[model samples]
Target: MANAQLKEEIIAYSKRIGIDKIGFAAADPFVSFKNRLLEQQQLGFESGFEKGSIEERTNPSTLLPEAKTIISIALAYPSKLKNAPKSKKGDRRGIFCRASWGEDYHHILRRKLQALEEFILTKVEDAKCLSMVDTGELSDRAVAERAGIGWSGKNCAIITPEFGSYVYLGEMITTISIPPDTPIEDQCGTCNKCVEACPTGALVQGGQLDSNKCIAFLTQTKDMLGERYRKKIGNRLYGCDTCQVVCPENKGKDFHHHPEMEPDPDIVKPQLIPLLTISNKEFKRKFGRISGSWRGKKPIQRNAIIALAHYKEKEALPTLFHLLESDPRPVIRGTAAWAIGEFTEKSCEEKLIQAKNREKDPNVLYEIDKALKNKEFDKIQG
Candidate 1:
């Protein structure tokens, strides 16, 4: 009875602290999730960024010995950018996905989870709790699913009825045994929108994702993007929302409940060329607060190179030449070599030839070779 009263008080406190949705679940082992994760590993589909081993991820008890209940929270973020800057022909802008639009969700969710944890301690002195956001050993999606926070959608995102898939999920495991809430019913019946709209068909089927083909995962990778996916990524600087953007459930689901969750028009969609020359300190100062910047500026810059190439912006030729000649990163130099070829200019050949002499990395050399071949091919076609 006392625990039941504590649950109500905790829920009230959660709302006051700005948690959009809260749910409770038993701290039982996530049997199905473990099986799914093992299957993903077997198929080489798991994202390498996943935290902890399979054993540690699936069992909440391993994380907290006295754990009895898992408290799940979701904070809704804005789906639309207000007064977003346009990407014109010459001045193309790269975009970070809606999830990366605002303040790093990890920080936002952690604060809310901590508040709930404190409230729990206030009621139960001996109460023990462990909280984590996306980085924790426990799967935030699995905990949210079990706690009735939302249903796992076809895009492999937890889709809340209120916030669609635009909500950030986090959880807490507590010694206080609150009764578990029933899981939400799956509403993805007969919906194949997200799967079909996937750029690389990364959403193989339903909830299964091949991380290698996932543009969101690809965007975070520091190395060169695969040649086939180069054009497919378009101007995405960080993360891909193609799957979520195409979901029918997310239709007209824009939410602006939190100020910090709102996007800065200039930051989320910055000019592509400026990003190429942005210094390390400047990049951090501008992008440090957002989740997309977690992978650092390299991947974003690499994507910007790809975006510039996709645009075939003749204006970017000088910047591309500079990157090929001086950038320390092989991916940047290689991608710039490719981007230079995209521009049909006489100096492109000479610039690439100059870079070829200086370039030592086999991959960069190979890209330069490919670029030259493409130019030759274009000449033959012309």
Candidate 2:
């Protein structure tokens, strides 16, 4: 069988299996990507959630020995939520980014990749194949860019002409050699909306990101969020979409091709207050299927507190106070203290003072003192 004929068959098969876009590329070491990773490391900009070493990340051969071709696939997701719930004054809602809207994309993409692998094995019985989604060592964007599936956007996302940047990427490396696709030319030309719109200046420059300052990364962390980023995070319980939302290429691009990728409005945009006391089992039952819940309930709970603060939802003060005094996790307790500070109610001060007296953790104590000082500052300003 000719490699070109196999490539065509793979593309046809991919479409039947729900893959929106498919491209092939030679499996060579991603040299430029490795250099960028080294620079990110030296600058302390990595998000710390990345798996594997830099060498393994940029070299496809390291993941699959004798890798000759890499096949990249893209599946577009819906940008706008249909019949979305409203966030009223007393009932504020937190959002998970569009990437986390439907089922966990990792599972969806892996399922498709596995089917492709099985199909490839049927064509060439001796063929070797390895597939990965977001968690894979190989960079999906790098592979996608090289494979001509999309141009790497200035926001550091693979932006396809059909789907814009609202696409989930996955790839598979195989021993079979296929004619590679031409790389897309960079189309971001002169636009800097994504960089300018970044709340914390996380998009340090076009095509480069400082993940430490990224709200998307910050929301996933288990520790107390930095004070400066709390308000910037707004109502996002998990992930951030400002960069993608503001991209010119992504304008008016929304797809509902796959039923599994359709978002449930209530799940992606749940009320902020109830999340404060949600049990682990309840959290799993509600959010376990989405990618945003990967970091667990603590980060989401903490972000929910910050969202309540961002809205200045006085109705949440009682819940915040309870968490401040009684939540076992320091991140939760500390974040609750910070949320309480946003309120000008007289009881907020009293609650902080009471928590300060009983709080044994230095981090929690520091947050309590900061809230107390902020309350004092508000009084002075008034």
Candidate with maximal lDDT:
2
lDDT per residue as tens, model 1, 1-382: 4778888998999889898899999999999999999999999998799988999999989999978999999998898888988899888899999999889999988888888888788789898999999999998889999999999998999999888999899999998999789999999999899999999989999999999999999999988888999999999999999988898889999989888888888999999999999999999999999999998999999999999888888788888899999988898999998888777787898888888888889999999998888755478458
Model 1 per-residue lDDT at 338: 85
Q: What is the TM-score of each candidate against the true structure?
A: 0.98, 0.98
lDDT on C-alpha atoms for all candidate structures = 0.91, 0.93
Off by over 4 Å in 2: 375-382
The per-residue C-alpha lDDT of model 2 at residue 52 equals 98
| Model 1 weakest lDDT span, ten residues long | 373-382
lDDT of 2 by residue, 120-188 (tens): 999999999999999988899999999999999889999999999999999999999999999999999
Clash totals for all candidate models? 0, 0
Worst 10 residues of 2 by lDDT: 373-382
